[model samples]
Target: MKKFVSLACVFTMAVSVLAGCGSAKTETKAETTGETVAESTAAAGGKLIMATEAGFAPYEYTEDGQTVIGVDVDIANEIAKAMGKELEIQNMTFDGALLAVQEGAVDFAAAGISVIPERQENMDFSIEYATSKQVIVVKKGADVITSPEDIKEGTAVGVQMGTTADFYCGDLGCDVKQYNKYAEAALELMNGKIACIVMDSLPAEQLVAANEELEILDAELFTDKYAIAVKKGNTELLDQINEVLQTLVDEGKVDEYTINHTTK
Candidate 1:
């Protein structure tokens, strides 16, 4: 009986030791996981995912069928480099770009986005990088439909959906046909599907110059300032982008890019 009791006690001691060992293993794993989470959060700093509508020429667009190149892309890259972070460009529609930043799907957006009070209510904006006026594009040598009033009552104006041009057309009571992309609208204008295409003057000029079949009216439409946009309340990121933008402007880098890319 004494020998049996001693053996049972030995067995109990072994089980307790194994259980304690298992607990220590679990605690170590938990500590490791906690530390990993903390490190991941810290390393995410300034590593930005930037979204843009890649169809907007001179601002953001694809080149050589593979490379995404534009003023916005260049500026964003410079900003990321200055911030000591990585930049990932997500090609998306203008509305999608805005939504991505708002939902934390992207860190920010730079799509030749115009800054307006309505948009400011939902998203933050960096310092304006470019200024543009709205313009109408039509077939070259066609009677210049220079002004909104010149558009015939039944004429249709093509515009990118969710853009300021769309809103401007609606406000002017002009008939509008919305396209998913700027290139689509430009194509429709080329095909005479729409009487005119309303867009930012700089891009419209670039497109018209390239196509040779289209021309822009001399009259100006609404003027607006374009800026990088971020999610509302993202003051840290907003301030950083603004600082970078101002530096570019002050150092004449912005002018250099404009001169290099502009069609003389």
Candidate 2:
């Protein structure tokens, strides 16, 4: 009888030990899962939707069967990651891009958007990531439009709508033809629909490199300061974006993108 009691007590102690170990494992697993959930939640706060034309090469354009990729795309991706969000780039017209950000239809617009006083009134802009001059692209050895001064009255100048080029050409007293995409305008220039294409210098170079017949004119029209734009008064998001952009600028990430992604 005493021996039976001793064995029963031993079995009870073994059972207790097993139960304690099982409880500990369960608690540990639960804790690990909870930590993973928290980390996931912190890493993702939905997608940060960005509006871009994706027609401006070296800034943003389609490649690899409609995959939007460029310098601005890369920069925007980094900014989104810094903010702990996924990036969703919405390709559209340049004018439409600005309107989308202005109307809060997207988080921000980052398609090499130039920061001008007019844009400043409608939307807040992040720090300038790039500076490019408005340049004239024309056929090789073109005699009529040799310089900025030659782009006077009656010159059929093509420009992307809502761009510094458009604004500058309008001021030039030339016949300004506005297109949604700079690529279209470039095509127009190639087909002789327009005398010249006024665009940012970097993208003009890209176009020139792709088409053997095209060349950028010697004169640069104006300087364009590229930046990301958010709706006015959205200070919180603007601040976050600026913080990330400054970090990138300080670390020379912007220059890296310009050097590597620039096709020309």
Candidate 3:
């Protein structure tokens, strides 16, 4: 299951963004060998595929249009290396990445995924390796949603589908527009299509810096811990990942990766 077959499933199901962006990659081990990615001549062991959406900055985002890179990539790569396997990344929509891991179409997902009770039912998660808060991004001086208390029934808001932001706004009775990419949602906000965007604080910072007209509203929405998602019942791989994550935390490499990817 962890052989060459792993690549075929992803290219067919969740690679719509590859023509312009990229994808994370993996394989699953059978009873004895426990191989979840294909063996490559390039690696003495094999490959571990990771699924991610390259739209969230500092956590996961592509600097060059062709290759995806960020804190998640760095952490996933280190996890792969520690297990003696090479890492391959696939970039797709956030929702697609979530489904891919649950389906075991890829080995795991490392897209700054939040560990929540709702998602825990479908997939297993590694230890919490990162943290982020939800924030509102609105046009500067637009008093539309200055505080979470300001959100009203049917207030138009934007969020990436299947993210915590989506859940937050929906629960609060916001009329939500769910986009596959935060960039898409941001465009709508600029065009006055949506009142604001609900996104992670790190990515909101990146978005605000890139667009002077947008500012993250002054209010705390939600704080979420980020973790890697593995196929449910895949304890072998989950155990391997948790070990690496613990080491990264002990060495402060997680923070180092975040700083390196974050724009000054």
Give the per-residue lDDT digits (tens) of candidate 1, residues 104-186.
78989998898877788889999888888888888875664656677645568898887888777877777889987867877
Whole-model lDDT, model 2: 0.85
After superposing candidate 1 on the true structure, give the runs of residues whose Cα lies further than 4 Å from its correct spot. Answer: 1-42, 144-146, 151-154
Higher-scoring candidate on TM-score, 1 or 3: 3
Tell me the spans in candidate 2 whose CA falls farther than 4 Å from its real position. Answer: 1-45
Give the Cα-based TM-score of candidate 2 against the true structure. Answer: 0.81
In the range 1-264, model 3's lDDT, one tens digit per residue, is 675688887776666656334322222222224443323312433778999999989888876786988999999888787777778899999999999999999999988799989999999999998888888899877777788877767999999999988888898898989999888888899889999998899899998888888998878787988999999999978988998899999999999888888844
Q: After superposition, how far is residue 152 of candidate 3 from its true place, in Å?
A: 2.8
**lDDT, candidate 2, 1-264, per-residue tens:** 999999999999999999999998787666557444334434445588999998788898887747898899888888777766789889888899999999999999988888888999999998888899888899776665888888887889998899887887787788999999766887787788899988988888888887888898778878888999999999978888888789989999988988887734
* lDDT (Cα) of model 1: 0.80
| TM-scores for candidates 1 onward, in order | 0.79, 0.81, 0.83
Q: Tell me the alpha-carbon RMSD of every candidate.
A: 10.0, 14.5, 10.1
What would the C-alpha RMSD of candidate 2 be, to one decimal place?
A: 14.5
In candidate 2, residue 130 scores what lDDT? 88
Please report the TM-score between candidate 1 and the true structure. 0.79
